[model samples]
Target: MLKAGEELDMRINELKKYDTITIDNLKEIIDTHLFLTNVFSDISGHNNRSLASKYLHFHVPNMFYIFDSRAIQGAKSYVMSDKQLRASLAPFGDKEYIELVIRLFTFQEHVKSQFGMTVTPRVIDSFLLNY
Candidate 1:
């Protein structure tokens, strides 16, 4: 849990920079701040994937996905099930997280190519959720 004002403001301000950051820059941010790894440190115990992803998605919607158990399950069966996905997810980090992001980006491009740009990340997420 973040503190009342200054801490929250700082976090929000920090997150704003991620909106246009590249994958490598994102990795550095994650490494430096432990954005996902140390999320919910105040109240929620330790590394919580759901909360982490939700927090990241709230800040960087176009780049991050809300990766909960359901999303992972759906992705395993419907999107990525290869050895690479397994290896990437087995030990989650900046590299693996960015890999997942790239996979989603690729899938979004494929969806756009197949069904036109009418499809958005939400649409793809809906499909993944239902799948």
Candidate 2:
């Protein structure tokens, strides 16, 4: 527990250097999420991607996109059904968490252009959850 807290503290400090999420800083954001997931997974002996992402999202809501089975399925479904989205999305690679962030960023832009309203990560999560 002590080690886990220390690891989290260190990651939080690293994350504090970033003021916001942007295409330029996205790699660092994803690296932070992967680092936290590995840290907790090492301590807990379970896959911690979802938990790590949720925790990071709590601290940096605008920067980190929450990941879970439901949201993954929703994103997959939505992307598959939208022709323009399929063409626009970058090809997914081995890092699925990175793919999710890219998808969410693209989806956010799509929504803003289609509806003339900007949405946050939380709003995107809600849409995915209810999709």
- lDDT leader: 2
Q: How does each model score on TM-score?
A: 0.56, 0.73
Which regions of candidate 1 deviate over 4 angstroms? 1-36, 81-99
Report the Cα lDDT for candidate 1.
0.53
* TM-score, model 2 to reference: 0.73
lDDT of 2 by residue, 25-126 (tens): 666677778777777778789878888889988987777878988888877766534344333332421266766777777777677779997787788898
Best by TM-score: 2
Off by over 4 Å in 2: 1-20, 80-94
Root-mean-square deviation of Cα positions for candidate 1 versus the true structure, in angstroms: 5.0
After superposition on all CA atoms, how large is the RMSD of candidate 2?
Answer: 4.7
lDDT of 2: 0.72
For model 1 the TM-score comes to 0.56
Candidate 1 residue-wise lDDT, 7-92, digit = tens: 54465566566543343444443442345455456556765655666665666554456666555566555455245543544443
